[model samples]
Structure formats: structure tokens, C-alpha cells
Target: MTQKNKMKKYGSLFMATALLTGALAGCNTDEDTSSSGGSGNSASGDVIKIGANLELSGGVASYGSSIGDGAKLAIEEINAAGGIDGKQLELITVDNKSENSEATTAAIRLAEKEQVVAMLAPATSGNALATVEIANKYKVPIVTGSGTAPNVTVNDNGSVNEFAFRTCFIDPFQGTVAANFATKDLGAKNVAIYADNASDYAKGLAASFKETVLANGGTVVAEEAYVAKDVDFKSTLTNIKGKNPDFVFIPGYYEEVGLIVKQARDLGIDVPLMGADGWDSPTLIDLAGAKALNNTYITNHYSSEDPDASIQKFVEAFKGKYKEAPNAFHALGYDSIYFIVDAIKRVDGDITGEAIQKQLAATKDLSLITGTFTVDEFHNPVKSATVLEFVDGKQQFNSKVNP
Candidate 1:
């Protein structure tokens, strides 16, 4: 769906319907490459080509590697099921190393060099945003399993980036959910926000969480900033400790978040700690330790502990295949493949970027492991967010927050 065509289909809503970019899930780059078989658009042959621009290595590698593994699993399942409408799907992967520039380069390579009709975008917001123009220029729809920032789909001018789509909810949504869980569920009358100043993802979540805190008749006792790679947080946690807040919200990815959680516990500032999905990583436990992570919480896409039949089934399959439990990024990665294939199957005739783009935009109630959602005009999935509590160094499903 080109911007012009989208305007005709949805009208001026898409114009003011746009959003500005102020988000980053943050990607780190890795130097590696992989391919299944054959390249180029499936429209040219019987095998559909899919491009994966992922953060297979580098910082936040857990996010990229998990997503890649999930996408690979989905591709395997589809191919084993006799493929998409009898045409096999080929995943051509390029490691973005979790960097924004690398993400853009990967997109270009996949779209122009590989000639894939659609591409899977980098998992983080900043990296995903870097590829928007490329996706638009090439008219190839790029679906992200975990790009949860407004800017990924909408441009700064509030214009919709028609070719970009995400399976995860935006950062603001998860942030709001966190605030609600803290204030209402945990009975926190005062919440302190410790945001990663270097991350647009953290910044966006911080702003929304503050707004919700005030709206809920709660107080923002303290607010502090930290960069992405800072190892020490005792100074900041000490300041927060003085404030005597009932809860602490740290909006950051796992690497830093793990350190903060551990240091906070060491400082004896043991009020409940909460964050967005950025905290979803096994490394978090290794960093924070099981005892330190006891009261930590996060808003995530899916819980490995969910009792839903479909979710449990997926959990078992993922475990059986990977020999480890699948994280949210993995589930998102897996779901993204189905999302793209679902649209491809719905294309009227030959599968092309434009056709797949339109179908993706029109997707309604598409069921997947993360959440069932209808793609909104913003090119985001309208779905539920799960709040998980870290108990004994593992994420346990706590509750679900609906939009």
C-alpha cells in the first residue's frame, strides 16, 4: 500500500493519522549472513523469497537471535505444511548487528539486491526506523515482530509510512500498562521513573508512564536518567531511595536493566520494580540474580507460562525444537512470518510488494502466538499486553492489560 493509495482507501485520516518519530528499540549489529535457498521475488517463480534483516549478533543479540530463530521455525512449519499455497518460502537473512545504519543497509540489500517482495525488519525501534524510507522507496512491506515505537510506522510529519508494520504494541502502550499495574495492581501511590536517556524507547515509555501516573492520582516522586552502557547505578538508585517512592519503573533494555535491578537490590531499595518489554531477556536474570529479580515486573507480548491452549502448544513446540523456552522476541519473530505469509496468501494473483502491503494493512483478527490483532491505520497491531512478574529469575504471567 503506497501512501497515495492508502490516502484513497482510508482518506485524510492517514494524513493527520501520521505520527512523528521519537522511538528506538535499539539494535546492535553483527557480521554474519545466512540463506535458505533461491533469491528474488516469488512473483518470478514458485518459491517466495523473504528477507530477514535481524540483529543476529551484537548488543541486544538476545532480541535478534530469538526473533530469527522464531522466524526460522515458522518458515520451517509453513514449508513442511506444503508451503504457502504450494510455493515454498525462502528466508534470506542478513545480520544487522543491531545497528540502525546496518538495518538500513540490510533493507536495501534485501529489497534491491535480493528483490524480496517483503522483508522482516530489525527488532528494535531505531533500527526499524532506519529502514522505513528504504521500504517506502522500494515499495516493499517490512514487518517487524518487535518494533514497538510510533516512529517505526508514522513519520515525524504525522504521515503514515504505509509499507511499515509491526506485530508488537507501541512503547507508550506498554508504559501505560506498567503505570496502571504499579498504581492499581501494586497499590503504589508514588512511583519513581528511571529511564535510559540514550534510548528513545525508554524516553517514550517514561513520558507516557508519567502521564498515566498523574492521571491515576499518583505522584512521580523522582525521575532520573541513565545512558545505555553505564555499569553503575547506585548513585541514581540512592537518590531514588531518598525519595521513598512506593515503586520504581526502569524503562530500558535487558543489559542495563539487569545491572540496575541488581544494584537497586544491593542498595536495599526493594520496592517493586517495573518496566516495559525491554526487560524481557534471560540475561536479565543472570545479571540481576534470582533474589534481586524477585519483585521485578515487565509488560510483555506473551508469557511462556500462559495456560492458553495455543500458547502452551507453541511453548512446547518451541521448547522441543530449540531446547529452551522462547522469549517474547522469539514469539514475535515467529508470528511475523505467519503475518507476512497470511498476507501473501490473500494477494489476488501474483505476490508483489504492493499487493502484500495492502493485504497486511487489511489484516483482521489474525491469530498468532503474541496476540490476535487487527492492523490499525497507524500500521500497528491493536492487541493486549501481558504483565509478567519475575519470580526466582523467571517470568511468571501476572495479568493482561487490554487497550
Candidate 2:
């Protein structure tokens, strides 16, 4: 053979071998099966693994732990009843260390490593934002149980991230409702704001409340901020006292809110305290005492006393298990899991994140323990919020507001 011809033949043969090797490497094999035990098919004998990222330790551990428990309960129930698409539901959970970015990263790593089909997350807004980018990168559907910030799904590009979803109502509506109740219902003209500066939930709710109050011709006489871990609020209370406002607005979780209310009353500031859903906890009454919690108004998801069948069933089941009535956080956590399960049932298959997201977007009129929820275009829940007043150490449902 001529030299050029031999060279061309050898090159062609080498190219053909390389192509064959690449094709063989791309073929699916038993070793290539996912650790989730599935061959990427629903008919295959595989356990569907769902992941949970929450704050099992740290400052907000109490709330996060409860959320994790609620999710586990839902998974248990589903598994007992023969899980979605005749597959067993497996739950994987990790702690995000109560809003720490490093902890969130670690939890995301664990979920990704486990190859979870979907993930439920950190019970607060800050941690939710911290982990969302990672979930988006991996294309895992994450449904947060307690993150209420308006930006949870709405991005700067005016497009919703396909991987992100939430089960709670946004902060804007809760803040607006609180402000409206303060102005129209409570007839309070001058209000003072005490916000937790460290929490995105607190800050966002406070800002929304301020805007709504101003729009309703209610004047904000004073504004004070504090960190989440700070227990002493005497300084802020002293400042708010001088303003002589008709009421005080505290946008923070029950832990800090209870302390703030107790200390405010101790400091001889007797104005009624108003807050958002963060105040919905049994511990709040015990921490703040009946005297401090008296006349305090807050917005919440569902009341245990609600006559609705769904709410009643959840309350009974929760009380039977935990020996205490479930709080708004617990209800939201429970509902979030069931909501995701319903989506899974709707899109029956090898549960992919994209499939769950599409199903969630189409969710409408889902009757849940919290309330009837419909996922809006922005992925926010359109539902009703119940207004509760702590009177005589009990939460009394005053009214329900629809958004």
C-alpha cells in the first residue's frame, strides 16, 4: 500500500475504535442504576427517596425539628398506605444548622449525594434562600414549609424558577392583613414596630406591614430592631414607650416575641401587641404568661378549633401522636408533604424534580389541614389566614381573611 493510503486507513480504524468505545460507555448497565434502587423507571423495584433539609440544631432548632417531624409523619402515613405509584416512599433528612450558609451547603451536599428525587427544606426564609441555588443547579424540586418571603419563587428576571415551590402564604399578604387588622379592626392609629433584624422573615414582614399601615393612613410612630438571639428588649421598649403609640407590631418568631412581650409589659408598656404567624406557638403563652399575651393578635394558618373536617382530622391525629395541638408551623409542615405527595400522584412516574414542579404549578383547590390552597402564577399560596387573639391563655379565632 502507498504510505499516504496506509496512514489514512490506520487513522480511520483508530477513529472507528474510539467511536465504538464512546458508544459502549454511554450504554446503560446494572452498575449505572441509581442508588435510589430504581432503574429510572416506576415499574422497577425501587424505593422513591425524598429528602428533607431542616434545622435540627442551632438557634431555630425547635421550629425546624418540628417541621422535620411533621414531614416524617406524612411519609410514614403514605408508606403505610402503599406509597405513590405502588412504590415505597423513603425519607432522607439533614440539618441546615438553623439558617447557616455552611450548614445549608452541607445539607445540599448530602441530598445530592443521596440522589433524592425531591427535597423539603429549612423552616425559615434565610436558610431557604441559602439552599435554593444549589437545588436549582441540581434541578431538584424543593418545597419549603415555612419560608414566606415574596422572593422565594419570584426572581429578578420576572420568571419563576422551575425547581422552587412553597406551601405557605407569602409575607406580603400576612403583613398586609396584620396591618389592616391593626388599623381597621383594632382602630389603632399610631403603631410602633419591633422587628428582628437578623431574620429575613421578620424584616420582610415588618417592611410589608409598614407599607400597608402607611397606605391605610396609619402612622408608624417608631421602629426598633433587634437580633434573633437577644432576650433583653428593655432598651427598645423604653424607646417605643416614649412614642406613646396605640399598639406595637412585633414581626418575629414566638421565642423572641414572647420575651419581648413579657419585658415590654414589665417595663409598664401596656399597648396591645400584634404580630404575624410567627406568634403561633403554645410555648409563646407559657413564656410570655397570660398577662403579657392578653389582647395579643396574630395571623396564623389554621386554628385547632376550626370546624373543617380536614383541620379536625389533622388536629386529632397530631394531638394523638404528640399529645398537644399542632401549631401553624407543624400544620404547614404536614400540609407541605401531603401537597407534594398529591402532586406525585398526579404525575405518576419515576418522580423527577421537573415533573413535581410542573404538577405543583397546576395544583388548585387542595384541601389541606392549613386551608384550601391554590398555587398561583408566582408559586405563592392563595389561601385564607385566620386571625387569633390570645385571651386568657388560649388562642381564640377572631376571624378569617382571604387573599
Candidate 3:
């Protein structure tokens, strides 16, 4: 062949090699990138990215932090055990600043930017409700550790959102349980309820409690409302005291409940103080003192004193890791991670958000450390709750109330 022809052939071969290399690089760049935080696998296939939106700072900072820690512990344990499907779990957690809409927006950003497969929200009902719209829009599955309001899973039109689910029982069920315990077990014929009207959790619980109390032949002598951040309850307490009810039910968080209990007792309101699951916090006793907490009863997810094997194992593992016993929120937070992981394992392929949602909807009889959890049609846990009493500044398990 001529020298010019040989040069032309070599030039063509070089151009072909360059084109092939460029195409391969483009393919590699197009591959999904994984993240290193949150609950699910990352986008790059190297790790799973799970998004966590919590009230990590603000008035509910303590509760949010504890729940985030619990979720992190679970993720660490899962990673240490070889992770899900041989991929490292990454958490992309964002602090919601106790802003409901902001938290929801953060979750949406994580789903879009981080490309997370699933999300776990160890947050409040208000925040969870805000995020549910985004989850439904994007088909992202969200498992809430708290967020017990019935409306969390249902839209304003009363349609169930398949993407939204919770590990905790609904507030209505918890409220009914609390009311039954007060009227039948505590022998309280007349009850007064003080609810945080600003909180869906508090309002729902109070409504259900009032309905249950009246249905069971007991009366709600006084029903007062308060905002969550309000510290002064004397005015409300004074009004509640005028009713002279045998029991006072405060359906709110530990912070407000603690203050209300202390002020109520100081004002000579000696009636037994009853509350929902929100009262199961160490801060309740620390802030309210044992004197104020004495004779207080509250409904909870699980008790540290329970001898159940699942509960014992969880307590041991949690204490060994965090040097503290797990509360109801922590337990549920940990379980929420496992629930998502379990659903992910059951699913096949690229781990899209839609697949996770379907798997979550199909979840049945999931036996976690909390209890045997079965997601009802409304995506709420159909399980039993432990009734607890505050005895000498400690939560003592009194009995189990089944729904």
C-alpha cells in the first residue's frame, strides 16, 4: 500500500478509538451516584441514600435529636451487618427547624437532588403532614417514627396516600385508650381535658378522648385549649379546676405536659393527671418532679420495663450503643428504619421510589422491636399499647391495652 493510504488508515483508527472512549465516559457519568447518609441507598449504586427530615433544632429539639440518634444507630447497625443488598447505607438528614412546610420541602429536595429511595421522618405530625404531599407527588415512601395524627396518611379529600405510612398508632386510638383507662381503671367519672389546639396530634387525641369518655358514660367537665409553646397554664388550669373533675387529661408533649402538671398540682388541683404517648419522656419527670408526676398515667408504644424478648433485645442493643434506655420515640424510630430496609429487601431492581411504596403498602405482620405491627388500610399501626404510670419518677408498666 502507498505511504499516504497507510497514514489515512491510522488516522481513521485513532478517531474511532477516541469516539469510543468518549461514549464510555459519558455512560459512566450518566450512572446514578450514591449518597452516604440517611436511610436508603445512594444514587450512584455505591451506597443507598435515605432522607431524614426531623425537627433537629427548636422547641422540640430534644425529642427530634433523640429520634435522629435512634435512626442513626439503626443505620450503623445495618451497615455493620453488611448493609442491604451489599450496598452501604447513607443518611442525608436535614433539620426542619420545627417548621412543618420547611421540613416537607427539605424531604422533596432530598428526593430530587439526593435521589433517595426512601425516607424516614422522625418528626411531628404537622411536619409529616406537610411532607406527605411531596411524597405522594414524587411517589417516595415515607415511614414516620412519630406523627400519630390520622390525617398524616389521608389527604384533605379523605383519600389515602399510598406513599405515606407510620409505625405509630393513630392519635384517636391512643386517645380512646387513655379515656378508657381513666374512666374504667382509674375510676374517674368526670374528666377535664387540656389540649394544644395548634398541634394535630394533641387536637386529635383530645377529640377522641372526649368522644370515648362521653360514650363510656363519663363526662368531660371542661375542655380547654392551649398553644404548644405556651408555658403559662395557670389561667387554663384555674378554669379546669372550677369543673372539679376527678381526672385531668393533657394531650400534648412532655414540655407542656410537665409545666401543666407542676402548675396544676401547685394550684391544689389534686386530680390524677393523665396523658397520651407524648408523656413518655424522661424530661417529663425531670421537669415536673416526681411529686407532680405521682399518680400520672399515660399510654405508650412500649415500656422499658417490659419483659418481652423483642423489647429486651432492643433495650440491650440501644443501651450498649447510646448508654441510655430507649424511649417510645426512639424505639419507633429504630423500627421505622428497619421497616424501610425490610421493604427494600423485598423489592427487586433499581430501587425506585414507586417500588418502595408498593412494598410498604404490602407490609403485613411486621414483627419489630416495638411490637407486631400491621399497617392498616389507613397506614397506621394496628397494635397494642402499654399503659404506664409514673411511680417515684419512673415509668412503670401498668397494663397492655389492645385496640
Top of the candidates by lDDT: 1
lDDT of 3 by residue, 1-403 (tens): 9999999999999999999999997764454232212223334566988888888888677767777888898999999999987988998888888887788778868777777888886478888888887677566788888888888888768889878989888899889999999989988998999988888899999999999999999988898999877889898899889889999889998888899999999999998888987777787888899998988899988898899987898899999989998888888888889999888889877677777777888889999877887777777778988898998898898999888
Q: Model 2 misses residue 62 by how many Å?
A: 1.8
Candidates in descending lDDT order: 1, 3, 2
Q: Would you estimate the TM-scores of all the predictions? A: 0.89, 0.86, 0.88
Which candidate has the highest TM-score of all?
A: 1
lDDT of 2 by residue, 115-165 (tens): 776788678877887777766666677888988886768875798866678
After TM-score superposition, the amount by which residue 64's alpha carbon in candidate 2 deviates from its true location, in angstroms, is: 1.1
- Please give, for residues 1-403, the per-residue lDDT of candidate 1 as tens digits: 8989876878655554453111121211111111212222446777889999999898978898889999999999999999977889999999999899889999989986788999899988989999998887777899988888889998879999989999899988988998889888899998899999987889999999999989999999999999998999999999999999999999999999999999998999989999888888888888889999998888999998888999999999899899998899989999999999999989887787888999999999999998899999999999999999888977899998889
The TM-score-based order of candidates, best leading, equals 1, 3, 2
Candidate 2 lDDT at 293 equals: 86
In candidate 1, residue 314 scores what lDDT?
A: 91
lDDT of 2: 0.82
Which candidate do you rate higher for TM-score, 2 or 3? 3
